[model samples]
Target: MTYATPPRRTLTALTMTTLLAGGLLLGQTAAAPDASAAGGKKVVCEVDKMRQQSHSLRARAARLQRLGATAEARKARAQADALDRRVRACVDADGNAPKPWN
Candidate 1:
């Protein structure tokens, strides 16, 4: 009786496949953020927080406009626009004005 070993080509292919799978796993792990401490808290990234604030300000401005406080409403809208721009910048740190939250 005798035992047969895998051919050289077969071993090579299996090793390459293993290496490729390991690389993919490492790549995915590196791309994901650690969520250990963020279990309970809603982790709003910087760009998202700016977007939410801008949205809230816009709503406030609309309410003020409905209430007849035109001047204050304009000011609030201006602030909101500025914050929106900040969010855009965060989304596209480059000079190119790419739509941030759409």
Candidate 2:
């Protein structure tokens, strides 16, 4: 029995896929230092912005709390708190929280 050769389209597709995967791996591994700036420090700045957003959300929650709808206020507060935790994690880069996350 003779082995059949792969179709041209299939061979081309595989080559393209391999090249794309290789490019992605290289991009992730040998990322430029100036861009990422060591341990994703640039992302930490983004984290700060996200945390500020969470603070704003919490502020809205506080306003609702002041309006005496305690249940809705608690829900909002909890959502804000979760965002705050995520932002803190982004800032810390190793699942650590910043001081005064509350």
Candidate 3:
């Protein structure tokens, strides 16, 4: 028995898929360095901002406590704690906080 050839459309589709996959891989590798640089800067800046906010929240909690606003103080402290956790998670691989250039 003779083996039948693959249909034309199937071969075309397979070729197109392979080309598209290759193009995507090439594009990603080509852009990766620049993307990481830009994204790293942005992440550092954002984490810095979050750290500042968390600090301010803790201060606010302290002030509220002084004013005898126990409930509000608790809330502020909780928010600050949550922000601290998120900042920790976003810290660099070396476990250092991101230092923004600016």
Whose lDDT is greatest here? 3
Compare candidates 1 and 2 on lDDT and give the better one. Answer: 1
The CA-based lDDT of model 3 is what?
A: 0.86
Q: Considering only N, C-alpha and C atoms within 3 Å, which residue pairs clash in candidate 1?
A: none
Rank candidates, lDDT, best first.
Answer: 3, 1, 2
- By summed lDDT, the worst window of 10 consecutive residues in model 1 runs over 36-45
TM-score versus the correct structure, for each prediction: 0.47, 0.43, 0.47
TM-score of 2: 0.43
Report lDDT per candidate.
0.83, 0.77, 0.86
Question: Model 3: runs farther than 4 Å from truth?
Answer: 1-45, 92-102
- Candidate 1 per-residue C-alpha lDDT over 16-49 given as tens digits, one digit per residue, 9 for 90 to 100: 9999999999999999887654665753348777
Q: Report lDDT (Cα) of residue 61, candidate 3.
A: 100
Candidate 3 residue-wise lDDT, 7-98, digit = tens: 97789889999999999999999876664655566444378899999999999999999999999999999999999987877774436745
Error of 3 at 23 (Å): 36
Off by over 4 Å in 2: 1-45, 94-102
> Which pairs clash in model 3?
none
